[model samples]
Target: MVAKAVVKPAVELPVRADEDSWTEAELAEVRATLEAEMAALVAEIAHAESTIAEDGGGDGAGDDQADAGAKTYEREHEMALAHNARDLLVQCERAVRRMDAGTYGVCESCTRPIGKARLQAFPRATMCVACKQREERR
Candidate 1:
């Protein structure tokens, strides 16, 4: 007699359709948050650019060294902040796209509906907790 191998099916994720889906109020809140964050990032970028232009000036030897140090520090800090802002913007854009596609709170990895709490915290997560952990491990 040949032994039959049993295979388990992958877990099925829940889907929120129509009336069971995220409320209008929840979506409004997320939109508001994304807008606020985007605005702040834009302002920061503008300020950084202005500072950089102002800092680039000729001065005496001692003053030149100090200015160089200051400029370097400012450049590094601004670069980091700009990178962070750009990443956030990308995430916000993805969230908006998901909302339009009716997959806002769905995990991309496991095809499961992400919890409301997670959505509230992240607002841009593409994977559920379990799948996220699995991915990170690799």
Candidate 2:
């Protein structure tokens, strides 16, 4: 007698479809999108860090006064931009973590499933459209 080998399907994050449990396919699609976003954000953060380090000059030595001022300004600007990138990266990581925890589709504010269209555009979003708008108005 030949033994039959069974292949189990991969487990994926749960996504809500029309207020119902998401099929494995839907979850897989959303998971792929979120994972891609997380990877891109991490790469962007790394690039920003390296660029900031290259532009940063700790001491004012071997530079003219005007050049030093320009370097200082540029460093500060670069640091601010890098900080924003880091913040976005954090959000992306959080979203990925939520996916792993089986809570990826819900809004953090109202505990509702985030809209599908919104998720498509912003994979790292933590709030639903209503909550986001309310927060913005405050």
Candidate 3:
């Protein structure tokens, strides 16, 4: 069976970023993408936490050195995955907040419009390409 697509209400952005014009369709699409990604990331974080707990709670009494090391590695790997997911989740949340605050597509550093193409490519981006590159260099 085919899954039904969710119909999200169009986002009414009162503030446009600089000279860039964002249509209601574009804003709705971006909002949908961000919300979907956020949901997936939350699920991933929960799964990773469960995996880490299961792996770390085992007693090592019967395990040899290799087995112990492998379990430790798996637990650490899950922790890292969870950490990355958490970071992404934070970014998504911040983007949503910016959208609500009427500053979604504006570059935080340069106060310029982050191009629509860039935002379409990375919904969580808070800076334009130039500002991002400069930030990376610093």
Candidate 4:
């Protein structure tokens, strides 16, 4: 017996269907915001890494218990900050890729246009407000 091939529906491009979608000017603005955020995150990550490295070289040769504890705490704090910066940088990079692919300003989950106001407030968003709310609830 021959098996039937399953045909999937064609994916729709992220064309705007309503005023809620982004305008060209809005897209440009979002791009600029993402770029600025990415630059700041990169710089922050670099500084954190440098501070962590500089603090790691100490042998604690003459340090008291409190000094060692303080150094450890500071190093851990810098590491946590660097990790968060890296996460934000990755999100910014993904937003830029979506813009290039003509898929920006659309919700990833529902395939609907995200609201302009939401995008302006949070350029790293990949989903519409409703979808994001549902996700957060889950």
Candidate 5:
């Protein structure tokens, strides 16, 4: 009988230090990144809303159904974009709150430390890469 090789999963990197161990500089960097993102998101949402509103206004130049349909489609697309931006803004704001609470960079699911690289790429990530991947697999 041939024995099957037992494969083990690769161990994830050790949990990075918690926020408590982080220097003021580290926390400040995250705070600044989150705040900047929030500001950008808010501005984007505002601009999208304004544009959508303007597009919805009937200039009375073309009262045809085709023009109305086209305008409707455009308004819908812009609203979707604004909604996505709003969601991102909420996430950024939540990250800021977590920073203030000294819980930023900690995975919400496994409670593991989210790596600095991941954090740098996505300052509002609430889950570590491993946990996020696992969640996606489900």
Candidate 6:
């Protein structure tokens, strides 16, 4: 019988000794990226609210049936987007908290420094790439 190979867990990287492990420049970049994303999400929510408001401006007017249907669809779509954005905002807030706690780059699952590239792509990631992949599998 053939034996299945065991997958080893990824190794953790050493934490930097300096108080501010990440360079000030890097922290600034991350802050800017997060702020921009937050602004965009808020704008999207405003736009959705405006659209719904416009659809419901009239007071018991003609074509109420069509207006009701359109308003319902818009509300559902807007609500979904709002919920997703709210969740992402929560994640972003947690990442910012980690930065303040001096554990921003360290992966929550393995205590490893998530590489610069990964941090740039996913600033809110709490797990390293390997751990994240493993989580997705389950």
Clashes of each: 0, 0, 0, 0, 0, 0
Tens digits of per-residue lDDT for model 1 on 1-138?
996434221122233343244566777787678778777877877776776566655453565777778867877787777778778878887776666656677788778777766777887788878889999999
Q: Candidate 4: which stretches are off by over 4 Å?
A: 1-21
| Per-residue lDDT over 1-138 for candidate 2, one digit per residue giving the tens place of the 0 to 100 score | 996434223233334466445566765676687678668867877887788887663677788999988988887887787788778778877776776666776888998778656776787888889999999999
- Local accuracy of candidate 3 as per-residue lDDT tens digits, 1-138: 996544333343323344346677788788889999999999999999998877777689999999989988888888999999999999998988777667787888888777778888899999889999999999
Local accuracy of candidate 5 as per-residue lDDT tens digits, 38-107: 8899899999999988877777585699977887788899999999999999999887766655566779
Using all chains and alpha carbons, the TM-scores for the candidates as numbered come to 0.70, 0.72, 0.84, 0.82, 0.77, 0.69
Q: Which residue pairs collide, candidate 5?
A: none
By TM-score, the best candidate is 3
- The global Cα lDDT (0 to 1) of model 1 is 0.68
Task: Please report, in order, the local distance difference test score of every candidate based on alpha carbons.
Answer: 0.68, 0.72, 0.82, 0.80, 0.76, 0.70
- Between prediction 2 and prediction 6, which has the larger lDDT? 2
RMSD of each: 11.6, 6.8, 7.0, 7.4, 13.3, 12.0
Residue 64 displacement in candidate 5 (angstroms): 3.8
lDDT of 3: 0.82
Worst 10 residues of 2 by lDDT: 5-14
> Which residue pairs in candidate 3 have backbone atoms (N, alpha carbon, C) closer than 3 angstroms, thus clashing?
none
TM-score, model 5 to reference: 0.77
The 10-residue segment with the lowest total lDDT in model 4: 6-15
Q: What is the RMSD, in Å, between candidate 4 and the native fold over all Cα?
A: 7.4
